[model samples]
Target chain A: MAVVKEEEFEFHTGQNRPAGVPDAIQFIDVHKTFGSNQVLRGLSMGLPEGKVSMILGPSGTGKSVCIKHIVGLMYPDSGDVVVAGHSIPSLSDDDLFELRKKFGVLFQDGALFGSLNLYDNVAFPLRQHTEKGEDEIAEIVNRRLSEVGLGNANEKMPNELSGGMRKRAGFARSLVLDPEIVLFDEPDSGLDPVRTALLCELIKEVHAENGGTYVVITHDIMSARRVAEYIAVLWRGRIVEAGPSQELFESENEFVRQFLAGESSGPLGME
Target chain B: MNELFALPREWLAATGEIGRFMGTVMGDVWGGRVLHFFGESLRQAGILIVSSTLVIWALMFILGLICGTEGAYFLEANGAPAYAGVFAAWCDLREIIPYAFGYMMAAKVGTGIVAELGAMRISDEIDALEVMGIDSMTFLCATRLLAAWIVLPFLYLAGMGGAFLASYIAVVQQVGFVSSGGYLLIFWEFQNPPDFLFSLIKAMVMATAIVLVGCYYGYNAGGGPVGVGTATAKSMVLNLVLVHLIGMLGTQVFWGNNPNAPIGG
Candidate 1:
């Protein structure tokens, strides 16, 4: 395991938003380690506001860890994570919880409560955070479910849905809160190509309508090409390259080129 | 040698973690969210009863029968056949029932909780709860703990009643060592209110420990399916040891200096 110190990289403190594009989230030289494994080493990047961004990386990279840090499920060992101008590492517990109200995360498996049906799962955050009447909650839940193409599957248990349907349900649940930031971790992990394409289209449509910052973490090159407005390629616990989606697609960086092309022979060895 | 040293260190760390978990649960019990999750916790209690109560009742009943039969044979051979009723009542009510309930609880309820929460942890449902700004500790661990604390006492009382009934049937009706009237008279003669209270306390304490241990292992579970299985197994082992220790401690605290028998004193 290679250890990259925080001093090795120049940190962008987010005081100055990138030119013509406001960053919705920024990681300034964040470092995290799990025992002997250094998962995120001086990692720094930013996701532009009101756009669809994808963190593209290999399987063992810290893509999921990045999502966790953004949500305050995990904290950095060093440096800071700033979400919508608030420093994540400095927020108190109550403040962090308040901060999380601005976020909606969809885990790879949907993370739907096994005991609750689809309707209840989508309505969970609203029920916990707000005092909305059942009638209004029902309206909002139905609309979001319909938006994600899960309108008729309201009564189904998570275990009863197909992999693609589960992902769609998760997407609907994530949107029910009308969050300012929506994060999806590996949204197309187990779906077929056709299903992936449909899900990608649904995500794009959702982003277009909601107009919030949406960050997707995945290794699917096809999905990235289809849905990403911004792309960050992560490797070996660092950002290999990051920029606008078109620019990143045309990146001249050897590692980014090899990873985007899915070529076997490149800086990223088979190991 | 390293394994031996590491074992105790790990145990101490786990004990501290359980203590912290219990503190958080207690804090949540007083928070506004307690009532919010009460119905859900009660639903969990209902599930706990459905899953573990019958097994608890059956196990205690069989043990009661064994105690009665064994006591009768020895007392009759010793030329004091009438004492069989007193022995059965005293032993079953005072010690065996609580211990039996603890064992069955560790085996059934503890492992069940570990499996359920382990599955939740691995599947990211717990993380989803946190991400949604719900206190997963309060919602998941505290609710289960509250449910166990509420329902376990009643379950123990029911199991105790079943044990006494089984003992009566075994000693007086089945074994024919004593008449029904004679057994009932002597049994009530030896039973005391404090003994029942102490036994109930023991059951509740053991139940709390079981819940805390299960939640700790499950909430922190990692790896995958194999990790979940390992967590469940570890919860069972810890619960068994803690149950025995708590049982002994409760017995000493409640009945050690003063054996509060109805007639003997």
Candidate 2:
């Protein structure tokens, strides 16, 4: 990590500890602006392959925007996002879509197709991307549903399910394709503490079993403590500090220390 | 000066944007890229058939009855009650039925799509589809356009049959100014197969525009439920304007110079 200017980013030491593994995803000086509001300003970071990494940031700190860039749903204004060695911005539309197959994203709301039940929602990617017959699809869909503890709820529509159930169903759908990189955008959002813990446990269990790169975008400190092996604390579109979760929790930097400690009296304030 | 032209400039910009969007969707369909999602297209076709068919036909039937009654009374007042079928033929086949079909499509299918896709957009369902490696535009919009192309012609033709039947009933049975045989003879004499084909073309054009406009507004909808509502309203307004524009142009292009009536000849 490079030290930024003294006035603008005084607390930003930009200390990014090496993951000791090749990056599965990289944001190279990426900058994104929506109208006059710049969301990501020179955001450069990397997520280690084959690990559960969490992008820990305060609310409205471009955390979810990072996930979009990783999956090619958004393009940066001035920089590149490299995923699995492919430059996302440079790829043609066909190639971009092909590269997206490596990713499975769970949106905040689950975003399950309202028209499809849990069973069909989980089966949707398979039905569109695979030539497998209904029997095979059902087998896979049932297994994924059971893994999410929604086996009995397969026939339920998305609207019929609770928020936690919908998120779990979305998790099942994300994993159905057996993607190489799975991104969860605020998996703990709109859930009780117990359900959030359980969802985090599910993430850990799934990561351990599958052995793929997993990135969870969230501001939940408890979730970060439980699920993230690698942690990136971002603020103002730039990474303040990022490293192994244990190291990040023990950091001496003011902003990282205060944020990871969930303290209010620090350089961070309501702006 | 800039302020003076601002509204028209904004309108031109929006029109250009819509044109580009529609061009992309049209290209996807024409270039057969939409066929990659042919199953989705078929699903949309089925939905159109199930959800919109009856409503459209019912509206056309009602309009047909109005046309028939109006034509019958007008011809009878002119001491040409026997020529009632000629009025009914032109009304039902050349003008009223097509306009009725456009009106119903704008009200029912077009607004329905705007609401459905607008909800999807606001809820991040469209984003989910994109992240899933699916081309959301082709899956969501182009497939719909293809579906409309596939299903609407048949639906329109069937609705036209309903309209024709209603016209016959209103003229021969309800109005009773002309007998069934007299109405049948003049009606058959007035409209040939070409007129039906022309009318079908008009209605099909309106359907295409309505579906495309619905897709544009819905797919780009933002701001949340209120935004979706706004988009639905905007799509309805644009669809109605387009319906009337296409209707007027169709009439002029198809039947302006030659009324295509046996009596006129």
Candidate 3:
């Protein structure tokens, strides 16, 4: 178990990590519109090479949409989303597929293959991306499975696993490619608090162990406080407040105060 | 008062939904074309190769048995020459089975592929696969198209054998004058080698068209499970229609715009 610093996990309300740390991912002036409904309006952020940068926002603020562009699933209407250096839209399909090797994303639900058991499910990306023989694949798969604390549940189907274990399995999949930049699209969603707590612990521990860049999209204030070095509150597609988590947590921004204080009377609507 | 206009609106909505699903279908086809440019679809070709051996042997034995019996039966009953009866049976073999079997294979395998992919689409698995960097088209469509092209000729050979065997068996064993050896003599004498080749060539061309159409519809099927059922129906019907058009066009090329090719006289 590697050490995760207490200061590194402080609460912030906007995107600003350790400066001069060198960005592994840089999004500059990115605009994405789906048939005239503008999802991202000039969005920009940088993920420092070996730290966790959490993207906190309300629903429909284009969290999944943002990650899709990173993987080249959808192209930005304008501006740049450069990953490991190359801009996304300029890359061809084969180039995009090759570039995706650096990414590991845990989708909201653990999207394991229904036909495949847990062992095979975790082994899928390795088989697709690498030409490793079965013995090597088995070794890698078991090591990842144990990392998420599911070493003994190798033969179970996804349906048989609990919500917590499924998410853990999804996390296990993210590490299969040995990705340098891990992107989590709300890892805490729909999980019980106990599970969420364990997951938050795993996220920090994995970061410390691997020393890779992390981008998490979450609004769970507790998990945000637990794991994020810096946090950005994406309200209506603008970073209302962003800085070091500790500084922002102690700051005077109305939205930040209202948000961190967990008040119901703020501008955030039920709609 | 304007509620009556809902009927027309519903119809237009249906049209638009179909239009969008069709756009998705065209997208699959375009992707398939790019991959297929390097060579023929290996899936279709494999199907042609495997079905060729089986259909050939099965149809040949059937042709021999049927022609022998049928020729004898006609010779004894109608007093027509046994050779005439065998030629008539040959006419059926050279034409019917080749076209019908092509259509059947298209119906069975073509509809099955459409349904399979359609279900995957309905279940949201397709979207999931895309996010994972797996190009679903290259994996699914390439295999199907390759199998069809590779296996079509084999089916036609079997069709030929089946038609001849059935005719031979009915002619001799049921009626009696055409001996077993006589049936073989009649088949070789009356059968033109080009006719057999022509049947296979037609099946080969039709198989490619059928498989492509099947994959195109299946990959983009709408309305989930119901959409899959609809797409399968559409692919089968479309395959049948395309086969007719290709069959006619193939006949024209061989027969020079005549209904029948200028051979077997």
Candidate 4:
């Protein structure tokens, strides 16, 4: 394990103000590494239940790795990750799979099964986990697709869709199961500004209607402004400040202010 | 000095890793966990039948022709033209067909699996399946192995028929060294039902090893498209070596003591 230099983390206040709600996911001193490059270093944070929380970070700052940890796709090297009262790394494979039923994750490019059309991709989870007939599955699949604005593109393959459409389809697939938690890894990536705002709006509308613990991992300050009810600004694997979205936007910490405001001048710079 | 052994050490490590991965997938099938996705297995079986069966049969037929032509000329030169059937029968059934099947399988199905699953892994489709609470190993790898098991035997049998027909045409029709009836007599005289079974076993074993090796490489593929290409190349090289090894071992074990000759009798 490579030692994290102390001075490099001077602005890492780790100030996690309460979101005034119970946590849906918690990372306790989570340290993850790849070979010699440590991504998450002594990181601890909490995402409150039934709110859209944004994990805001610059590029390559462990934002995506954090989402993997929450879903048990990757485990921490030293610390623990608890999702809805279940320790991620300690659970058996079967148990971990069962626990994953509570999660719906949207990968960056809408990882829809290439073999299936849009409709079947959305219907996949319901068919796997439920005894519902094709009629019922179709109803739920169509409904979710409609919610994501992909209702008319049911028969199209993933490659036929544009980047934003793929993300929307992925979002639709993620919601079909009515899971208790949803994790979106850079939902705004690869989209134009208008589409990003539209996706942010779609996220807000869906959260209002369905109400789950939605964690969006992104660096887009506009997305944070539009979709985040709670915010955690991560840098160098540690949180600089986290709180209600307004509080994080108004934070006094230099790193937090720079990241949230997207300013050029601050403690954060090209390393 | 340490660098001297590094490449071999890496190969050993990779072999062990692939062995472990194959064991887990085989365990999933043996434990009936794969039944959870039986439909997927059936789908894969259908894919194998539709996509690969004819190509395999065509290759086998072509090799059978080569085997028969070579055997006929050799026996004709030796003044035993009437016994050309002996060479054709053994060559087609014992070695040529199985090796051809293995070569085609390694080239087609093994590399196909690596490319498909490698793409899935890179594009996060496998991760998506895992997060959806599916046991991806059972769903993806074990189902593929089971599919190969279910479909390859019948396909191999049919391909053997094609090879036999091609060999008969080459020796009796084209070479004209023996009449059809005489060729049939010598052919039946050289091989028994047990020999047929041994040939089937040899071919099936090669198919199994190819499928398992493909799954191991495909399921664990990383890096990206280039990585997948590398894995596919590695699987092909390994499968070719395994095909010849299994071919040699099968012949030694099945026909070493008694060559099943009717000459002395």
Residue B91 of model 4 has an lDDT of: 96
Q: Weakest 10 consecutive residues, lDDT, candidate 2 chain A?
A: A1-10
Q: Model 2: how far is A69 from its true place, Å?
A: 1.0
lDDT of 1 at B241: 89
State the weakest 10-residue window (summed lDDT) of model 2 chain B. Answer: B256-265
Instruction: Give me the overall lDDT of model 1.
Output: 0.86
TM-score attained by model 3: 0.73
Best by DockQ: 4
Error of 1 at B204 (Å): 0.7
lDDT of 4 at B163: 90
Ranking by TM-score: 4, 2, 1, 3
Higher DockQ: candidate 3 or 4? 4
What DockQ does each prediction reach against the true complex? 0.78, 0.86, 0.25, 0.92
- From the highest DockQ down, the ranking of the candidates is 4, 2, 1, 3
Interface RMSD of each: 0.6, 0.6, 2.5, 0.4
Q: Model 2, range B1-265, lDDT digits (tens) per residue?
A: 9999999999999999999999999999999999999999999999999999999999999998998899999999999998888888888888888888988898999999999999999889999999889999999999999999999889989988898899899998998999889989998998888888999999999999999999999999999999999999999999999999998888888877674533333
Task: Give the native contact fraction of candidate 1.
Answer: 0.73
Model 1, docking class: medium
State the C-alpha lDDT per candidate.
Answer: 0.86, 0.91, 0.70, 0.92
**Residue clash pairs of candidate 2:** none
Q: Once superposed on the true structure, which residue ranges of model 4 sit more than 4 Å away at CA?
A: B259-265
Candidate 1 displacement at residue A178 in angstroms:
1.0
Q: lDDT: which is higher, 2 or 3? A: 2
Worst 10 residues of 3 chain A by lDDT: A1-10
